[model samples]
Target: MYESVLVATDGSDSADRAVDAALDLASVFDATLYAVSVVDTRRYGDSALSGTEDIVSDLETQANELLDAVEKRADGGVMTELRHGKPHAEISDYATAIDADLLVLGNRGRESGEVIGSTAERIVRFVDRPVLTI
Candidate 1:
């Protein structure tokens, strides 16, 4: 029943698992797939601000590279976007901006080895749409 399905990834194993799940759901529903990756700019704060631009640039490069891999793996049609901001906020905002029907996310993100990642939890709290975590 979904028209647009968006999935967020950080190129981690967990996110990769979620990617597969999202892809399957989109395929089954015949929905458009949208992939999103966020480059957290907070990593380059304070004294690191001097090289923040360069770091952000590098992150974008890496993000695009990862997104390319994701596109290839998706097999089906997929649109991708990269943004610089807090992961949860950017993801939620992007979902709303794109008017996605569903959000599919990993149970854990890059830094989270637990049952649930902080970013995913924040997204659940901030986002008004339905979320499916794999």
Candidate 2:
């Protein structure tokens, strides 16, 4: 029943699972699949330090690679986005902006336990769309 599906990835194993699941779901429904990797800007302080640029650049590069992997795995069937800001906030805002019919994400991202990643939890509780966490 979905027309557009969004999946947020962090290059984690769980996120990889979510990507596969999202792809399958999108294929089943003939829906558009969107893959997003957010660069958590909060990791950096309010002011830019000497090496802050390097860190952000590295994060952005990582995010690009992650999105690249998702697109590759999807065989160019998915649209990818690289965002900057809080993971939950950016992902949630993107889903809303895309008017996604469904949101798929890993239960746990790179930084959280196996139960539920903070980003995933926040999106589930705050986003208006249906969320499926793997």
Candidate 3:
């Protein structure tokens, strides 16, 4: 019974699955789909610090492409967004801003650990919205 569905992706396989799941739900509910990709700016600052802008730009470009791919697969009435910040914070903020009915994301990411990726876990903790993990 969602009206607006937000899917957060990181261009990973798990995120792709999440996108697919979100798309299915959107199709079923006839809801608007919003895809978002968050670039982790902290990595550039924490690493050895070279080609930071280039790296961030590259990430943004990749994220845009990924979102475009998802948009192509969507049934219709879908929009995409690309942001730079902590993944969880950005996704949550976007959900709040859009008044999304549901937020979909991967249970784990490419860089996830034994416990859980910080982004997924943090989003679950911080957001009051319903989250569907794929």
Candidate 4:
């Protein structure tokens, strides 16, 4: 009975899997699929480094590309967004803002090394919605 399915992706392998799963669920439920890619600006800190702007620009570009790939793979029926912030916070807030019926995410992202990625773990704990981690 899901009406809106939101998936967060970082262009990582596991995120890709999550995308596929989200697509399947959306298709099955006839739900609208929404995809998001966050630039993780927190990693850059608040310092005014010389190349900080360039680095953030590059990250933004990558985020757009990742969102583009997801939309392309979805065959042009998905809504997408690019955000600059902490992954967990951005994603969870987005889910709530969109009133998503379900939130899907990768078990681990690019920076993950433990049993579960910190972002996914945090989202699962904090987001007040059902999360399906792939």
**Top lDDT: which candidate number?**
4
Q: For every model shown, what is its TM-score relative to the native structure? A: 0.92, 0.94, 0.91, 0.95
- What is the model-wide C-alpha lDDT for candidate 2? 0.90
Instruction: Indicate the worst ten consecutive residues by lDDT in candidate 2.
Output: 43-52
Q: TM-score of the candidate numbered 4?
A: 0.95
Please give, for residues 21-120, the per-residue lDDT of candidate 4 as tens digits. Answer: 9999999999999999998877767675345688888988999998998888889889999987889999988998899999999999987787789999
**55 Cα displacement, candidate 3 (Å):** 1.5
State each model's C-alpha RMSD to the native.
Answer: 1.5, 1.4, 1.9, 1.3
- Candidate number that wins on TM-score, 3 or 4: 4
Best by TM-score: 4
> How accurate locally, in lDDT, is each candidate?
0.88, 0.90, 0.86, 0.91
Off by more than 4 A, model 4: 48-51
lDDT at 15 for candidate 4? 95
Better of 1 and 4 by lDDT: 4
Per-residue lDDT, model 4, residue 22, is 96
**Candidate 2: where is the Cα deviation over 4 Å?**
48-51
Off by over 4 Å in 1: none
Q: Residues 1-134, candidate 1, lDDT per residue (tens digit)?
A: 89999999898887888889888989999999999999887766657856557777788998998788879988638999999888999999999999999999987877777888899888887899999887
**Residue-level lDDT tens digits of model 3 in 2-116:** 9999999997778989998998899899899999998887876756345556777788898889888887888445788899877888899999999999999988888776456
Show the colliding residue pairs in model 2: none
Q: Give the C-alpha lDDT of model 1.
A: 0.88
